[model samples]
Structures are given as C-alpha cells and as structure tokens.
Target: ATGGRYVPRAILMDLEPGTMDSVRAGPFGQLFRPDNFVFGQSGAGNNWAKGHYTEGAELIDSVLDVVRKEAEGCDCLQGFQMCHSLGGGTGSGMGTLLISKVREEYPDRIMETFSVIPSPKVSDTVVEPYNAVLSFHQLVENADECFLLDNEALYDICFRTLKLTTPTYGDLNHLVSAAMSGVTTCLRFPGQLNCDLRKIAVNLVPFPRLH
Candidate 1:
C-alpha cells in the first residue's frame, strides 16, 4: 500500500502523482500508490505531451520500454497489469498508448488492462467514447481478455447511493475493490486456486522462457 521501497507487483497507475500521494495518505494507500504502477508525467522521457487527451496516445513506446525492462528484472512480475480510464481524455489516449506498446513487447509477457469509459451525457468529454470503444476493441484483440466498466451502467448505482452530488470516492474505491476481489476470488481463496494456472506464461517470464 504505502511503501517507499519495493512496490507490490500489483498497483494501479491512474491519477496524477500529487493525487496518488493524497490517495495513499487517505487510507486507500495500498491500492493507489505510485510505486505499484507508472503513468502520468512521471519522467521527462515518458513519451507524453503536457495536454490532456493527447498524453495517452503519446506514450506507447515509453510504456513498453519500462514494462519490458521491469518484467525482465523481476520474478514476481511475470505478467504486467495495467489500468486506464475510458472515461475521456487521458484514460483512453494513454490506455491505448500503453496497450499498443505492450503488444509490441511480445516476449513472454501477457498484458492485462482495465478501463472505464464515459457515458454519452456525462459531459463534453463523453464525445470520445467512440474512439475509446474502438481502442478498447483493438486492445482486446491483443490482450488475453478485456474488462470494461461502463459509466452509464454505473450511474444508477451511484445515484441510488445518494451520490447524486457527484460520485463519491468511496464508491469508486468499492468498485475497484470488488473488481480485484472478483479476479482473486475467481482464482479462489488465498493459496487455494479453483484451477491450476500454472501453465508456464513463457511470455510473462523473461526469455528465453521457462513455461
């Protein structure tokens, strides 16, 4: 959650560095910290411009550079897990960039991504859902599987929870917690898997691979 040193292989790379720090201090530290994932103007050569929507599209090569090196170095990170919002602006652009770069690094690694897209009436930002949806489809083509969280579908739940003023951060956190729980649960309880996922993810392992 809050580590100055070794970050867990699992971290969500969303939000700005400043905001991520606040999220860490806010008690959701374990899930939304910087060390766990990388994105958003972290380094100068991050292959992104300062603008919003363009940043994601700008960093495809940069993301892959980091991922390839990272996966090669760590045994725990055989596969890379990434996240981006399909909501608008940075999420889709950046998510697409990261995913494109990932597919290029076709070693033994598998790239898993989670994205949330904006609803039509959400605001002016909603206009790009078409492009986001398209990019999401392309990513699905390369990824093992793609999971989509639709904002329109979620609005009813948010409205029902008295979050009409705006969606509460707590609600968002719960959603993330649930998604993660679902994945782990699908695999079964700790140390108890419902299936043997032991097939050598040769791509995930640094090659020459050991599957």
Candidate 2:
C-alpha cells in the first residue's frame, strides 16, 4: 500500500574507501548509487577517537552534501534512520559525528538511530566498552530516538529460537534486518497506526533520553 508515501532515498558512508566496492557488490547494492556513497581515507582500526576526530571530520562535507540532495528529493522529509555498530570504530565514532551534524543542520527533523551494542561474551576488541560508552552519549544527546540491538541477545536468539548450534555473523545480521523490517513495516506498507516517523517517535519516545 506504500503507506501513502514514497520510499526514502539512502546515503551510505564508510571509513575505508575500498570497502565501498564490496558493499556495491552486495545483493541490494543496486538500490544505492555510487554517488550516494561517501568514504574516508582508511579504516578506523577499532579506534573511536581516530574515527571521530579525524576520518569523520574529513568526510563531513561529503556526507552532508548527500544528505542535502536526498532531503531535497523528498516531498516532506520524514527523518533519518541510521544503522551502525556501537563497538566498531567507524560505526561508533563516525556515526556519532553524523548524528551530531544531522541534529545541527536539521534541528526540527526527527532522527532515529539503530545502534548495535557489542556482546560481552564474544567481544573481539578490548576497547569496545569505551567506544560503546562514548557513542551512546552522542546517541542520547543528538538522536530523537535510539533503538539498541544487543549482540548477546541476538546471539541467544540465533542459538535458541533458530536452533543453530553455531550461528554465523550472517545469521545474526539476518535477525537484525528482520527486526528492522518489522519496525519499519508500518512506514513501508499501509497500516492502521504508526505509519509515519513522527508517529513512531511519539509512541516510542516518552522522554528525551528514554528512547
């Protein structure tokens, strides 16, 4: 039913320029044009500070330009839906930076973020806690709503609900994608309620930091 609206345009960002190629080769890559992608000099190597202070700042203009173009295309821009991992360098640091910029540029617009928090049981990096903490502060301060995805919970779901003895990263990602699809289904298709971003915010966000 299209939810009485058009599909929103997207802009993808990455810290490593080379990674864009692989992303473009993915199944749904056709949905994103080359011009809609922005990249930094290199990967953040799990360093939050480096990604935030260096790579993120360097690509801010390009990112904003893409956002501006996308916003212009919309009849009435609903909001931004940012999906990123809180434990990684680019996702944590650059995601925070982008959220801050979006808030500054579009103060009246609703900004919702889907942040993936690292699992404590199978954490690969020692500095994940620091990255998660700092990025969370930005999510709380800048984003109108933040949906947290815990890796541990996701893993358990894969192991138990899916009945997988050893679930791969792809399995966990599928769960995440499914969850996102469910949350966004009301907006993507006709629904009795919560069919718009603002309505979703009104229903979910009771306070500034509650979401």
Candidate 3:
C-alpha cells in the first residue's frame, strides 16, 4: 500500500493533540504522527484491546458541508480535482451521505475516496466486518476510486520494515502516516504518477497498476 501508483491527501477533523486553537484547519495538514494519538481502555473491561464506535452521522454530515463550502470557495479552482471519501465505516458510511449532498451542490466536481478494509483479525469482530463490506460497497457505487489497504498486511509490512519491538499505537500510526505520505507524494509530484484524474475518469481504472 505504501508504494502505490498514485498518491492521495486527507482533510482530517482533528490535529495536534487538539486544543481550542487549531479548529477547522484546511484539509492540507495534520500532526499525523504516532505521538498525538489517544490510547484508552474499552468499556467492557480495563485493559486488553477494545475499539469504540459512535453514531457520528450528524457530525460527519456537518463536516462534509464545511468541506464543500471550502472547495467552492477556492478562487483559483475552475473545477475540483476529485472529492475523496473513505470506504470504511466513519469514512464510508458518513462519507457516502456527505458526497451525495456535495454532488447535489457541485454536480460536476470529482469525488474520490481513499479507504481501508478491515484485516481478518479486526474483521473477525462483527463491527468491522459489517462496516467494511457494507460501507465499501456503497462507496464504490459513488466514489471515483476506493484505494484499499489491508490493515493486517500493512501491519506486517511495518513490523518487518520498521523492526518495531511491539506493534504499539505509535508503530501503527507511523505506518498509516507513511502510507499516506507515499500516496500524496506520488500523485502530486508530477510525472511521478503514471496516471492522473483524467485517466482514472476516462477509463474508470487505476492505471500504471503499481502494486
């Protein structure tokens, strides 16, 4: 997933341990470092591993509206390059609903998504499997592309390459950030990418087939 044919960027909600100062920064930058993440114990017990979920539809919806407004506000922008969505639960589920509104708002602007599917270990749980398949399917219907990342396979790469002693939260976030950086660099650097937005839309494919 690190060395893909194209690169991508993100517009995340939070940034830099998230104090009051940096609310609603542009989609361009974030800490994206392992150190900034919060580690917590799940509600069931006080230790092992537990992932939490929220009914964040309203929040996601509002955020998408903000992004659409910003995209429209771009003075130099003739037309949008693409709208990116996430194929995962928060990204896909929340993302799908948001893009629909965006399409209504800006009919011709391109919308794309960079989402990850759950790994078998994570997918063994009911929530991830359900979210991944259902959300991803919906995303494929509307988004320009769903660049899939298998957490399991990616983690294996991190462990092997980074030589992490324990696959701690820090290690995991680093891997995710690195992969994102790789994508961003590839697409934005000109000539580095084998394909661009035109190729993807015209052919409906990820060309250059970087694997």
Candidate whose TM-score is highest? 2
List model 1 lDDT by residue over 1-211, tens digit each.
2355545544444424665567577754755335445556643222223222354445444555556555776755435555666544455655665566666765445565666655666544535656566565656555554555666666667787646757765676577668756754634554434322222222233432221
- Provide backbone clash counts, one per model: 9, 0, 9
> Candidate 1, overall lDDT?
0.53
**lDDT minimum window of 10 residues, candidate 3:** 43-52
**Ten consecutive residues with minimal summed lDDT in candidate 2?**
1-10
Against the true structure, candidate 1 reaches a TM-score of 0.62
lDDT tens per residue, model 3, 1-211: 1344322222444212232123225342243322222222112121111111233333545456556555665664323323222323434454455555666776666555556666667443445555555555555555554456666776687678777656764576567667656644645576634345544454556443221
Model 1: how far is 25 from its true place, Å? 4.7
Candidate 2 wrong stretches, greater than 4 Å: 1-8
Per-residue lDDT, model 3, residue 125, is 48
Give me the displacement of residue 38 in model 1, in angstroms: 4.3
lDDT winner between 1 and 3, please give it.
1
**Which scores better on TM-score, 1 or 3?**
1
Ranking by lDDT: 2, 1, 3
Q: Write the per-residue lDDT of candidate 2 for residues 1-211, one digit (tens) a residue.
A: 1445433377889888777877778877655656888987678989898778987789888999999988887798888999999898999998899899989999989898889898889798999999999998888899987888988998899888989999888898899889889888999898779988889988988876788
List per-candidate RMSD values in Å: 7.3, 3.3, 9.3
